[model samples]
Target: MAGYSRWIKPEVYPLLAPVGAVVGLMAMQLVRNVYTNPEVRVTKQNRAAGVLENFEEGERYSQHFVRRFVRGKRPEVMPNINKFFSDPE
Candidate 1:
């Protein structure tokens, strides 16, 4: 306790856990992005960009996990609320 107090103040103690948690989460996200994200993996491949390569790259990016997930969901409107207001009864 005495040794720790000399280096770090009591006031800063409460902040240490949260800060550490946030840093840990950030590091985990960085690792995930570097290892698992398609875009990052594609860039890391270090390939020369020819016409076919460019087309393939576009396809890869568009078909990334997030993109595919969002694309699978249907777009939503206000169920004709906008049209109802515009048309007037």
Candidate 2:
């Protein structure tokens, strides 16, 4: 639907590209992981803070993980800065 609208407004194509790429990658990941086919065991750690932090009493726990099958393979842990400070490598 969005693609079809591109013909009416060509400028919308570029804007749609980033969103399309993300959606496509997510869809591919879902299809790949549907059968529990993970080529590698990926371990990741994350820290969370701020207003949305999940806490109970005096204990503070924050971490999240999920299986994803995307076109890109994250073989290594790569840290990226916020978009405001992002730069080409």
Candidate 3:
């Protein structure tokens, strides 16, 4: 513990507990999902149904708020810089 002070900063100590708690919660949820979630327990009979479900999920995710907003905008890399250089004086 004493040697840890030399490697880890004192400022970071407060952040460690919250980060550990979040990681612990995520791990517990993962375990619970593995045992109780139907999506995890796929069978040969319902494999096609699972594929359809996945496709629908994909469509929903693709139509997400952020994706919808960005989709309407131009697909540009550094549009401002390009505009500035492209402008005629």
Candidate 4:
């Protein structure tokens, strides 16, 4: 037990702990941006309702300037052209 104490740096570890925490938070944000759905939202308020649009009015938008080679060209427009139904009132 005495020998193990030599390897642990109680003072240094506490000081550096916050650095590790900040790095983790920044990393999470980066991932979120990269994986964010690049789609034009309809409703703007209700995302769940948009899911239903995919079949009824929504569609997959490669929606970008650079075309995809594997599956085929996605929509030329970016962010996709989302369709929404509004109340006529």
Considering every candidate listed, which one attains the maximal lDDT?
Answer: 3
TM-score of each: 0.45, 0.31, 0.43, 0.31
Deviation in angstroms for 76 in model 3?
Answer: 42
Candidate 2 global CA lDDT score: 0.49
C-alpha lDDT score of every prediction, in listed order:
0.70, 0.49, 0.73, 0.53
Output the worst ten-in-a-row residue range by lDDT, candidate 1: 44-53
List, residue by residue over 29-69, the lDDT tens digit for candidate 4. Answer: 66644554444443447556544425323223433233335
Error of 4 at 3 (Å): 11
List CA RMSD, all candidates.
7.3, 15.4, 7.2, 19.1
User: Which regions of candidate 4 fall more than 4 Å away from where they truly are?
Assistant: 1-8, 37-89
Question: Which stretches of model 3 miss by more than 4 angstroms?
Answer: 42-89
The stretch of ten residues in a row with the least summed lDDT in candidate 2 is 57-66
Please give, for residues 1-89, the per-residue lDDT of candidate 2 as tens digits: 99877565877768788998999999986765543333322333221232333345113111213423432664544535443356655
Q: How many steric clashes between backbone atoms does each model show?
A: 0, 1, 0, 1
Off by over 4 Å in 1: 1-3, 42-89
Return the clash pairs for model 1, or none.
Answer: none
Looking at candidate 1, what is the lDDT of residue 1? 72
